[model samples]
Target: MDIIDLGMGNPDGATPQPVVEAAIAAIQNPANHGYPPFMGTASFRHSITAWYQHRYGVALDPEGEALPLLGSKEGLTHLALAYVNPGDLVLVPSPAYPAHFRGPMIAGARIHNLILKPENDWLIDLAAIPDAVAEAAKILYFNYPSNPTAATAPRGVFPGDCRLCPQVRDSVGS
Candidate 1:
């Protein structure tokens, strides 16, 4: 029997040698033998901050605005956990990825699925979410380079901070 590998829609790429060596070194270090900081190590955190600064030209405060996580997927679920209380409405797009559903499901959340038809170029009309659902919704799960469908939405689809809605964690690969 052939075993089908149905991923939770995660990227599959080899860790670069340099990154692997660094992880090895950190593991070998006696200082790292203990529990790691909840936020993460200063070196990695600084590296992340530097990336955002260099790419976006925005200096992030590592202490407040930035904290490193094990992975973006885990961080996203944790975001749902932090903000989405039970019975809170989570707005997700139709024909979506699993985590976009699962995260809120595990958080005991109800979804207000926003259908995205091809005619609209896969962008949601903010006006479409039912007035009651919009008022109740706590978080919106979305993807830009959409999974399964591979549709790319417009930049102005969501508001100023909507960039983060599907910003860092929604990528998928083989």
Candidate 2:
């Protein structure tokens, strides 16, 4: 029987030649053997900042701004672990990457799932959140260009003043 597997996030094709070559080269290098520094090498951090500058026209201080994580899912989960105490309220969009909520779950935080609907183009309706729930929420996780749904959200979807952080209005301009 022939089966089509779509659930796994495997690439449709073999690894690109340049990438494959680079990986092989790195594996052969003695310097790449041991575990890297916790924050990654200064060169790697600098490269990240440079990429941000080139791609988004954003200037970042490599030492302070660039964080080289093994993967976004792991980083996001660790972020929840770092900030969430048991019973803290976390707002998570349903139909999201499992890691978005899994981290908070592992931290023993109460999850308030914001159900996304096709009618809303899979966008989170910030206005739909109850005032009380918004006020109590400690962590709010939202994904744009969503993983499985591939839904994109407009900038206007985010209000200037976040209910969780009223002071962020100035920082997050309307």
Candidate 3:
């Protein structure tokens, strides 16, 4: 039998053998059936922080900074609902995954779309953002290896003071 996954970005292929074996093993274990902690398991959080430290040399506290979510869409939705108020300005890149802007829209935020241009290799032109807009924006959603466009920004693209933006949430590898 063949299976076709016509779902959102799912690969048209069989499940990897190792992953399938792992799933079978987990399903057979009673401990794996229960719900996990809301903040995720300590080991998972520790692993996340450790990955950050190794990959980017950034130190993060597992208990305080690391959060393991089911997926990016769900997490971003909750984040927007929790932080953004009605009419608050949010900066979202144009031609992005719906989740990038949908959450803010649902929160009644005023979205300012950052246009990605082929001339700029689809990267957001940080310098072009007006001073007033930058200052007024409540949150900026940035994605690299961007959805649809496949754009990637170089390291150090963000300014030291975050280019005067108050909150920047980067959704990498989306």
Candidate 4:
């Protein structure tokens, strides 16, 4: 019998040449023969810095903020471990990536789930968050380019407010 495999998240197009080339290079590199730095490398961090400064016009101190992860999922989990404390409140959006929920649990934080519905254009309602939850929340998980739903938010939805500080880390992702 002929068996076949199926998967999700595979690229619809052929793998790009540069990425293929990089993979070949990694296979041949003596330096990558073992486990690389658990925290990633300087060169990777520098590239992230360049990308942030050039594309986003956001300046980041590579040494301070550039974190190269195996993938965003693992990164967020470990990040929660680093930042969250026992009994601290975490705000998780409904219909979110499982890691967002699992991360908080791994870190021993209490979860305060808030529903994000389609009628709101998938934006978190500043109004919808309960006063008690908002007051107690120590982390907020936001995802855009949202999976399983294509909803996008105008930058206007974010007010650039600094006052939501004590409750959240002001982080967003996709």
True-structure RMSD, every candidate: 6.6, 3.2, 5.0, 5.4
For residues 84-121, what per-residue lDDT tens digits would candidate 3 score against the true structure? 99999999988777877899999999999999899988
lDDT: which is higher, 3 or 4?
3
Candidate 3: segments with Cα more than 4 A from true spot: 1-8, 159-162, 165-174
Cα lDDT listed for each candidate: 0.74, 0.85, 0.82, 0.75
- Going through the candidates in the order shown, the clash numbers are 0, 0, 0, 0
Query: Candidate 3 has what TM-score?
Result: 0.79
Q: What TM-score would every model get versus the actual structure?
A: 0.67, 0.81, 0.79, 0.73
- List of clashing residue pairs for candidate 2: none
Off by over 4 Å in 4: 1-32, 160-174
Residue-level lDDT of model 1, residues 28-66, one tens digit each, is: 989768877888778778888899988867798877778
What does candidate 2's lDDT look like per residue over 56-174, in tens digits? 67799998998889888889999999999999999999877888889999999999999999999999888899999998999888878876567997766777755754544454457
Which candidate comes out best when scored by lDDT? 2
RMSD of 1: 6.6
Candidate 1 runs further than 4 Å off? 1-7, 10-38, 159-174
122 in model 4: Cα distance from truth in Å? 2.0
Measured on C-alpha atoms, candidate 4 has an lDDT of: 0.75
